[model samples]
Every structure is written in C-alpha cells, then in structure tokens.
Target: MSGIATYRHTQKAPLGLLVYAVAIGMFLGAWFTDLQSVSLILALVGALILILGSAFQQLTVEDEDDQIAIRFGPLPLFRKSVRYDDITDVEVGRTTFIEGWGIHMSPRGGLVWNLWGRDCVVLKLRNSVLRVGTDDAENLASFVNKRLQTEERE
Candidate 1:
C-alpha cells in the first residue's frame, strides 16, 4: 500500500469465468465419469465457484491517508496495506515472466500483489519490500515519490 492524500485505481482481470468453468467442468466430469467419491466434493465446491471468480476478477488500489491499500476485488477477499512511513523507496519496475499474477511471496524477497500485467511499482520498506502491479505504474511511482518527499520535509 502507498500512503497518499487521495489516490485510487482499479485494475481488471478476466478471471470471472471460474463461475461457469469450474462448476460446468465439475458437473460434466461427474456426469461423464464414475469418479463418484470425489465427484460429490467437486460438485459441492464447484457451487462456490462464483466466489473464486469474483476473488480475482479485479484489483483496486487506493490511498488511506497514512497507508496504501491494495485489494483483489469485486470480492476483495485478499488485500495488503503499506504505510507511507514504512516505505523506504519507490520505483516503477516490471516483473519477470516467472513472477506471474495474483498475490504471492516474491522469490526475490517480500510480497507481490499483482492482478494482471508485469508493470508495477516496487516499494522498499523498512524491513521488506512490495511489488504492486498496476497499469499506471509511472503515475503511481511518481505520486508515491512526491509523497515520500513531502514526508521527508515534514
């Protein structure tokens, strides 16, 4: 999360198909096969596929005055926040191909909160780091740097 006076952005990801794909696949598998033992479990879990889809359908980033907040939405079941004071540095960067999407622990150390693309704003914290994927990486990085400069002056 990047602290700000006012900033908000949402990045969309086309992951909503889980609602139909998962449920339909499970239903079809159960109907076409005799994997009865696990079919019931699959069917039950499949019923909740909408939640899965919504969870990763989009990502929203905003300023919460003292911290930056990022969330995976239309269901925002997962999120991360970073304080302006905690950020030691910020820069616009890109993730490697292996980094992939969604939230994960970075192989390079720290946490990665990504939705889709590789464009991101990397922030170095006091004891950790965060790579927040965004389509507006340049603007985000610039805004964060301004905030950091302001914080230093204060």
Candidate 2:
C-alpha cells in the first residue's frame, strides 16, 4: 500500500527451499540421535540454518514510486531500496558462478542481492552498484530501462 507497484517479481528458488528442508531434517534427526551433546549441537545448528533459509528463500523486487525495493522473503531479514533518481544506468548482465546464490558482495565489485540465478540487472547508482539477480532478466531490464526513460523525460 505504498506506491503503485509498477513491477513486481518473486524469483522462485527451489535450492533455497531445499536448504530449508535439509535444516528441518537436521532438527528431526537431532531428536532421534543417541548422543545427547551432539543432538543439542545439531538442533542449534539446524535452527540457524532454518532462520537463514526462511530469511532468504526467495527474492522479491518491486519497482514503485521513485525507488526499486529488493527483499529476501519468508523471513525477510535482508532488504534494499534504490531510488530511481539515484540510478544512472541499468544493464542486463550475468553474475559469475563464484558469486553463487544469496546476498553478498560481488567479487567483480559492488553488492549483489541474488535469490537464485546468475542472470541479473546491474544498477549503477549515484554512489553504489547493485547486481539484482533475476530469472526474468529481459523483462526486468526492460522495465527498469523504460522507467529510467520516463524519469529522464520529466
């Protein structure tokens, strides 16, 4: 209920879901294990994994008003927002495998908010660069470029 959502996409990440499932399995295994100490440790670690997985199971990008908001879903512990005016350019690009999945600093420079794939839309902002990973690279790029155009016209 903030600005009119011009574009919204949630990148599905089965790998993320799988990671969460594994964490739940670990939790279950903890109960059946004979070693009490090991079971306690396993349960603690499983809880951590579960939190991370829920926090970043998917990535949602919304282009609304004057900014593009990026969020990691389910638990949404991480998020970012970039103003359209702050962005100088947008380019469709590919992230290196080293970057992998999840949010992190890109080896090639800048920060990356990726949910699942290697495809991304790189936004060169006034003070920073953000590589927003997306499965629908073409459409996201097109939508952003068009938004930039509209801003330039005004």
* Regions of model 1 farther than 4 Å from truth: 1-5, 18-20, 27-38
Candidate 2: lDDT over CA atoms? 0.87
TM-score, prediction 2:
0.91
lDDT for each candidate structure: 0.83, 0.87
How well is each residue in 1-154 modelled by candidate 1, as lDDT tens digits?
2433577899887656645687789777666667787778777776677566778888888887778888998876998888899999999989878888878889898888898889999999999989999999988898888888887887
Best by TM-score: 2
lDDT score at residue 128, model 2, on the 0-100 scale: 79
Question: lDDT tens digits, residues 1-154, model 2?
Answer: 2422389999877787688788989999899999999899999999999888888888899986888899998797898989888999999999999998777888988998887778999999887789999998889888889888888887
What TM-score would every model get versus the actual structure? Answer: 0.83, 0.91
The top-ranked prediction according to lDDT is 2
Q: Look at candidate 2 and tell me the lDDT of residue 134.
A: 95
